[model samples]
Target: MPHFYFHTENGDCIRDDQGEDLPDVEAAREEAVTVLGEILRYRGAAFWETASFSVIVTDADGRTVVSVTARASDAAPEGWTLQETGE
Candidate 1:
């Protein structure tokens, strides 16, 4: 098992000082997606008009494994296409 940090970036930095012990990176990815969905829902649909959101998952050694993001505008990052997927 390994500890992973789920840091959030919306308007400011949310440092994940307390991490969780997960079996591997795949588990972390699932957790991150679940967390990100919660955050987005909490913010409500109105918030998306103003800001893009992301959950950055990092390992114990501080290496980013994956970044799950929700785009807020027509101008999405290059190489990334915006798909309207609702859960």
Candidate 2:
């Protein structure tokens, strides 16, 4: 089992485990992005056009393994910037 840390652009975070059945970093990242989209929708923001989100995958010892950044489409609302820092 691998531990995954999901970090958002707005300072939110969550943790979960990637079981043996699904062991790829990219696969885990995709699932985290999906969860992030749901979080944006719950916050009354646009998941595909207004919200900018990202994820930092880390191992149990807090070592980063991968990062995934997702931004709203090019037609996103004004004043929205898709930037992330601190991996």
Give the alpha-carbon lDDT of every model: 0.87, 0.61
- After superposition, candidate 2 runs with Cα above 4 Å error: 11-22, 46-51, 71-87
Where does model 1 exceed 4 Å of error? 74-87
Q: Write the per-residue lDDT of candidate 1 for residues 1-87, one digit (tens) a residue.
A: 899999998877689999899999999999999988898889857446647778999999999998898767657567987789998
Flag clash pairs in model 2.
none
lDDT score for residue 32 of model 2: 65
C-alpha RMSD (angstroms) for model 2: 10.1
Model 2 alpha-carbon miss at residue 15, Å: 7.6
lDDT of 2 at 54: 64
What TM-score, computed on C-alpha atoms, does each candidate reach? 0.77, 0.48
Instruction: Quote model 2's TM-score.
Output: 0.48
